[model samples]
Target chain A: MSYKAIQLIKRPSGDLTPDIFATVELPRPVLEEGQFLVRQTHMSLDPAMRTWLQEREDSYIEPVQVGEVMRSYGVGEVVESRNPDYPAGARVIGITGWAEYVLGNADMQVVDPAIDPEALLSVFYMTGLTAYVGLIRIGRPKAGETLVVSGAAGSVGSLVGQIAKAEGMRVVGIAGSDEKCRWLEEELGFDKAINYKSDNLGGQLDEACPNGIDLYYENTGGVIQPLVFERMNRFGRIVVCGMISEYNRDQPTPGPSWVDINLKALRVEGFVVVDHQDKAQEATEALAGYLQNGQLRFRTQVLEGLDSAIDGLSMLFRGDNTGKLLVRI
Target chain B: MSYKAIQLIKRPSGDLTPDIFATVELPRPVLEEGQFLVRQTHMSLDPAMRTWLQEREDSYIEPVQVGEVMRSYGVGEVVESRNPDYPAGARVIGITGWAEYVLGNADMQVVDPAIDPEALLSVFYMTGLTAYVGLIRIGRPKAGETLVVSGAAGSVGSLVGQIAKAEGMRVVGIAGSDEKCRWLEEELGFDKAINYKSDNLGGQLDEACPNGIDLYYENTGGVIQPLVFERMNRFGRIVVCGMISEYNRDQPTPGPSWVDINLKALRVEGFVVVDHQDKAQEATEALAGYLQNGQLRFRTQVLEGLDSAIDGLSMLFRGDNTGKLLVRI
Candidate 1:
C-alpha cells in the first residue's frame, strides 16, 4: 500500500515558493508493537509553521529537516493499530505531519469520534489552547480592562478576543480587512475592531480603547505593534504569541523603544503552547465550557487536499485567510 | 534662616544644558506640628533624574514642574523636629530635593548614623532595592546561568552583577569605557566585561557569554541592547532597569524585534523601584547581609556643593561618572 506526503525540498529564502515543497508517494509503514498508523483527516496550517521551516538553532522546537515531511498538528483516525491503547477505528489528535497516513506516536490522544473534525481542530486543540494560555494565563485579563489583540480574525486571535469578552474585558481587535473587522465585532462580540490597513491606526486604536490598552495580545509584528505598544497602560501585560507579519521578511522591523516599558513598568512575555502542555486538561475544560455556553465561536478556511497545504500555509503570512487555515486530507 | 536651592527654570530640549536650572536662596521651612526639618547632607545624582525633568504625563511619578525644586533622593540629618517619631540628630534617608534644608516627610526612614551615607545610598536605598527587585525578584536567576548587565559600572547595574555573582551565576558587564570594564572585572569580580564602544561588540558578546545570555539587566539601552537581545537563550529574562543612553536623545532608538522573543519564549519586564517599596525591609536585610559578607562593594563620586548638581546630573548621561554620583551638601 502507498500513501501521499509532501516533503520539504528546500528552505524558503524570503517568501514561500511552490518549488520548495515536493509531493511524494511512499509505502505505508508496518506498525510495530505498541504503535499505530493514523489516517490524517485534517491538518492545521499555522503561522508557526513558517518558523519551523527556517534553519534556526535556537527555536523552541527543532526545525523540520530538509527532505522530511513538514511538521504540523492535526486530527486523524487510527485505521491499523498494533496497540491496545489506540485500537482500530479510534479518533486521535496530536502532532501529525503533511501526509495522508502517518505512524502515530504515544503522544496522540484518543478522542471521541462524534466530535466535528473542524471543531476539534479549531476549538479543542492547539488553536484553542494557545488562545486560552496567551490571553487568560499570560495576559491575566481583569474585568473592565481593555484588551487589544492583533490578527484578530485569525484562529488564536479570534478566540482570544472572545475569551476576553467573556471575562468582561473591553476587547478591541486589529485585523487586515474591514470585512474581518466586522466579523470580529458583530459576530464574535468584540467591543470594537479596527482594520490595520486603514489610515490613522493610532487614532482608531485610541478611539477604540479610550481607557488605554491594559493587556495586549501580540500576533502580527508590524506597524500595529508600535501603535498599540505606545498606548499600553502602567503595568500592562503584553503576550507575544506569533509574529506572522515578520516571519517572511529577511529583516524584521525593530519594535518600540524600551524607555516607555521602564517608565510604565510593563511586562512583555512570549509563550509557546507546547511548553504549557501540563495545563491542557484545564484549558480543554475551560474552552469546552465556553463553547457550551456559546461564548466561543470559530470559522475555518479549508483547503482541498494535502498538496494545497503548501499554498494554504502562505495564506497565514499574507493575511488572506479569515479564520483557521486547515487542509482536509 | 535662608538656604540655597536649585530650581528647574525650563525643560531640556534633548541633552541637559546648564541654563535649565537656576540657583537661588530660599527661606528654610519652619517645623509644623508633626513635621520635622531635614538638613540635607549627601544628595544622590541618578540617571532617573533626567526622566523626572521631562514633561511626560504617563510617567510613574509626577514630573518635576518648572519653577519648582528639582526632585532627588538624598540623606539628611534631622536638625529639629516637633514630631516625636523623628527626633533631633536622627539620620534619615528618603526623597528630598536639590536644597540645603527641607521639610521631612513621614515616608523618610531613620538610619543608623554610623553607616556611611554612600553605602546607604548605593546599597540599601533605591539602588540596592532596584538591583534586588530586578535581578532576584524579576529575572529569577538560577545558579550556573549566564547574566549580561549593561551600564555595569552604574549604581544599580554594578550591584546587580555582584548580586548575580553571589547567587553563583556567571556575570558579564557591558560599559562604555575600557577602564569601567576593568573595574567591573578586576574589582567587582564580574566574569567578563565588554566595552560597548569597542568595535565588534557582537563578537565580544558571543565570546563573553558562551552559554548565551539568560538574564539581561538593561540599564543603558543602545547598540548593546540589540546585540545582547539576539544572543538570548531560550526562556531568557530581560530586566529593563533604566535607559540612560536613550534618556538624553530627542527620539530614543527603537528596540529589537519581538520575533525572537516569541520563538525563545523570553520575558522582558520593566520596573520602577518606587513601585516595589513593599519589599524594602526584606531587600535591606538581604543587601546588608551581602555587604557584611563582602559580596557587595560600591564607590561614590561626590561633588563639592549644591550648585555642582546642575552639571553633575549630566555626568550620568555622558557616562562620565565611574560609580554612584553624589553631591556632598
Candidate 2:
C-alpha cells in the first residue's frame, strides 16, 4: 500500500549534502487503463543526476523539480498492470524514480525476464548505451589510433576504454588512483593506464600515447582534460560525454583554448543517451556481440536499499564507487 | 627584373613589430619546365597569416621559417609559363608570399582574367571558401535559426553572416566598433549587430538573439567567445574558423567551460579550408550564386605597394581594417 522514496528538498550548491534530500513514504498509485504498476528492483545512480538536481532552464532534459521524487533509470517488474503491453510479471526498463513501486509510463520497455538485472542495468541499458554512443558514434575511433579516456575506472569510462580496445584502438586510460589504473590496464585490456593523481600527468600521457591522442573520451574534466587536449593529433575527435569532476563546483574549469581546436582541426561533440533512443537496438546488439565474445566486462557496486541512493549518489562525485553505482531496492 | 618582398627576419613575441620583417628586392624567377612566373597584383592580408608566422610544428601547414618570405594568398597574372595548365596572361589564385613576383606552383588555380581580383580574393577565393565550408558544411544551420558571427566585418565573417542570411536564418554580427556594427546590420542585411567592445556585451547578445544562438561562427575568440558560448541553444554548433584575437599572444585565452556543451548536446568543430578542397567547387558555385543575386556585398581596405604590408599586417590585430585587407602593387 505504501513505498519509500527519496525526494529532493533543496537544490545542491557545490557538493551534495544530506539536507538536500528527504526520505518519505508515499501511497502506491492505482493504475488506470493503459497504465502499468512496476516494482523497481535496481535503480542506477549516475553523475548525470547532479545536472538533474540543478534549477537550470537550459539543460538537455528538464531538471527534477524540488519536492519531486528523484529521477533515475532502473529495472523493474510489473506487479499489476492494466496495460496488456506490460503484463503482470513482465520485466521492464525505463525512467523510474527512487521508489519501490511506481506507475509505469508508455516510455517503459518490456524486456526479457531471463536476463540478469545487473547485466541489464550495467551493459544493456543507459550505462552501456552512453559509452557506445559517445565512443563509437561520436568519437568514431579507428584501428591503430590512440584513445585517451578520463575516469577510466568508472562505469562509462571503463566501457569506453574496453570498447576502444575491442575496436583495435590503442586505449590509454586516466583514473584517479594507481589501483584503478592497474585495473584498467590489466583487467580492461587498456594499452596503458595513467593515474591522474601521479606526478607529471602530461609526461605520463606523452609516454603512454607516443603517437598522440586521436580520440579522447572525456568523462572527467580536471587536469586530464587540458593535458590530453594539448596532445591531441591533427583532426582529432573529443567526445564530451561527462564532466563528472566539475559537477559539484559552482564554476567549472575553463576548457582549452579554441586556437588549438582550430589549428588542429578538432571536433568536440557532446550527446546524451536519451536523445539517441533510435540507435538503442543497434548499440545493444553491438554491445551484446562484444559481451558474448567476452570483450565486454562490467562490475556493479550495489547499495542495499532505496534510501541508500541519497548517499550513494555522492560516491560518484568522490570517485568512491569501483564500477557502476546502483541501489538495489 | 627585380621585385620587392617582405621577409620574416625574426619570430614575433606578442604584438607584431615592423622590425620583425625586412623589405628586400629579389630577382624575378625564370620559368622552369613545370613552373610559371606570376606577377602578384593583389596580395591578401588575412588573420590566418599570423599563424603561418608561428614556428609551431603542429600548425595546419608548415610555418614560414624565420628567414623565409611571409606566406599569404594572392591573385596574380602569369607573365611567363612553361606549364601547359597555366599560360602567360592567365590570372591565377593561390598561395603567394608578400612579394611582387614569384614562381607559380602546381597548387595555383588559373582563374578567368575577366573576374576582378578584389572580388576573387574577397568572395570567391580562400576567404569565401573558408566561410562557406565553416558555416554551411560544418554548422549545418537551418532556416529560421540564429547565427552569431564574431569578427563580423572581416572577410570570412562578413561572408558567413550574409550566407546565413541568404539561407533564411536570423543573422547577428559581433564587431569591435559601432561603425562596423552599423555596416553589418544596414549594408550586409544582418538582423542585429552588437559591438562587443560596448558595455554589457552579454546583455546586448541576449537582446539581439531573443531565441538564443544556434550557430556561432567564431573568428575572433576574445570577449565574444564566452558570451556567445553561454547563449548557445540546445544542439548548437560552434564553428571555430579563426582565433585572430589570440593569435598574436604568447598564451591564448582559455575558452568557456565545456559543461554547457555536454549538458546542451553542443557540437564545437574547427576546420581549415585547405583540408576541404573537394568542396571548393561546390562552395564557389554557391558563393557565386549569392554574388549574382546581390545577396553578398564586400568592402576592401587596400594598402598601396608591398612595403606597406609590413605595417599593414598590424591593422588586423588592432581591428583597424574596415573589411578585407589587401595590398595592391
Candidate 3:
C-alpha cells in the first residue's frame, strides 16, 4: 500500500515553510511481530519541534536531516495489530511523523482513553506536564507569593498561570496581544495580564507586581525576560521552559539577564519534558483533577491536514495562535 | 583621645582614589551604657566594599554617604569594656569602619583568638564562609565532579578551590596572571590553572576540563565569564559571590552570555555572606581544620596604613591583588 508523508527538502534558516517541506508518496511497511499499523489521527504542533529542525546534533533530540520524514509527536488509531497489548481500534501516541499512517512496534506509547483526547494531545502529554514539573517541582512557588508568567496566552504559560493561581499565588501574565491578555486575566483567573507588545510593558509590570516577582515562569525569552529579570525578588526562582521569541534567530540570543539573577541570588533553570517521562502520569492525574473540578481551563486551535503542519509550527514563533496550536490529520 | 580615619570626600566614578578620601583627625567616641572601646587593629578589604560605595538605596546594605567613614569589616582589640561578653583585652570583629578606634557593644562579634588574625579577617569573617557556603551549601558539588573557579588566586576563590579539591572534585583555577595561576596549581593543589589573560582562553579551558565544568565559583564576571559559561556541563552549578571586574564600571558592563545558562540547564546563584552568618562557626572550624592540617594555603597582602585603603580597594577592581587584600591600622 502507498501513503503520503511530509519530507524535509532543505534545512531551514529562520522559519519552516511549505517550500522546505515536500509531500512524497511512500510504500507502507508490512507489520512484523509485536508491531501495529496506525492510521494518523492528530499531529502535535509545538515550539520544541522548531528545535528539532535545527541542523545541529548537540540538541536534546537529533536534528531532522534533509529528505527525512519530519520528526513529530502525534496521536493515531490502531487499524491492525499483531500484539494483544495494542489491539485494533486502540489509540496510540509517540514520535509519529507528519504522515497518513505509521507502521511501528510496541514502542508506540499508548494514549489513555479516559482523558479528553484534545487536552491530552495538546497539554497533558507534554506542554501541560512541562508546566507542572517546572512550576511545582522546580520553581516550588509558595502561597501568597507573586508569579509572573511569560507567553501567558500559550499552551504551557496558560496552564502554569492557573496552577500558580490554584496554589494561592498572585498570578500575573505577559502575552503578545491585548485580547490574549484579557483572556488570561478574565478567563484564566490571572490576577493581572500585561501586553508585551505594549509600549509601557515595564511600567505595567512594575505596577502589577508591587512586592517584586517571586517566581517567573519564562516561556518567550527575548524582550520580556530582561524586564522581568530586574523585577525578581531576592531569592526568586525562574522556570525556563521555552524561548519561542529567539527560536527563529540564527545567532545565539544573548540572555535572560544574568545580572539580576546573580545580584538577587535568584535560581534560573531550563527543563525539557522529554527528559522527565517518569512524571507524565503523575502530572496528568493532577492536571485532570483540576480540569474536572473546573479549576483549570485549556484551549486548542486545530488546523486541518499534515500540509498545514509547517505553517502551524511557524504560528507559534510569531504568537499567532491564541492557544495550543495542533494539526488534525 | 584622638584617632585618624579614612573619610569619603566624594562619590567615585571608576576606581577609588586617595583624593576622594582624606585622612582626618577626630575625637574618640565615648562609651555608652552598654558600650566598650575597641582599638581597631586590622581592617578587612573586600570586593563587596565597592558595592557599598554606590550612591543607591536598594543594595543589600545601606550605602555609605559621600562624607562618611568608609564602611568595612574589621578586627579590633577591646581596650575598655562595660560588658563581660566583650571584656577588655579580648579581640572582636564586626562591621567596624575604617577608623583606628571603634566603640561597640555586644554586637561586636568576638573572633577566636588563635586562628591566625589575618586568616580570621580575610576568610573566617566573610570570604572563607562565603566560599564554604557557596561551594558546599549552594553548589552541592559531588566528589569526582569537575569544578572551575574564577579569581582562584583571591581570598574567596582560593578557599573555594581548596574546599572543592578536599571534596575530591577536579579543580581548575582561572586567574589574571601566570604567577597567580602557578600558586593556585603548585601551592593550593589545583589540578589545572588557566591564566584568563591568555590569548586562547576557550582552547585552554577545553583542554584542561575534558569532562566539562560541573561547578563554577564565579568571583570575576568579565570576559572570562562567557568563556567558562559556554563550557558548563549539563545541570552545572555556578556560585556567584562577587563581580570584581565590573565593580569599577560606572554603567552595567553587558553580561556573561546567559544563553549558555539556559541551554545547559545551569543553576546560577549569587549570595551575600552576611545573609549566611548562621553558618559561620561551622564553616570556620571546617576551614581551620584544613589550615592546621596543611591541607589549605592562604595569602594576605597587608597594606601598611589606613591611607592606602583607597589604593588597596582599587587594586581589587583592577585584579592587582594576588591574595586577600588588607589594611593594617
Residue-wise C-alpha lDDT for candidate 1, range B161-214, written one tens digit per residue: 999999999999999899999999999999999999899999999999999999
Please identify which of the two predictions, 1 or 2, would achieve the higher DockQ against the true structure.
Answer: 1
- TM-score list, all predictions: 0.98, 0.98, 0.96
The per-model DockQ list reads 0.89, 0.87, 0.49
| Model 3 lDDT tens row, A168-274 | 99999999898999899889999999988788778988899999899998888877888888788888898888877777777766764354555667788777777
Residue A256 in candidate 1, Cα distance off native in Å? 0.8
Clashing residue pairs in candidate 1 (N, C-alpha, C atoms within 3 angstroms)? none
Task: Give fnat for candidate 2.
Answer: 0.87
DockQ for model 2 equals: 0.87
Q: Which one is best on DockQ?
A: 1
Clashes, model 3: 0
Which residue pairs collide in model 2, if any?
Answer: none
Query: Which regions in candidate 2 have their CA more than 4 angstroms from the true location?
Result: none
In terms of lDDT, which candidate is stronger, 1 or 3?
Answer: 1
Tell me how candidate 2 scores on lDDT.
0.91
lDDT of 2 by residue, A54-137 (tens): 877687789998899999999999999899999999999999999998889889999988899988988878888999999988
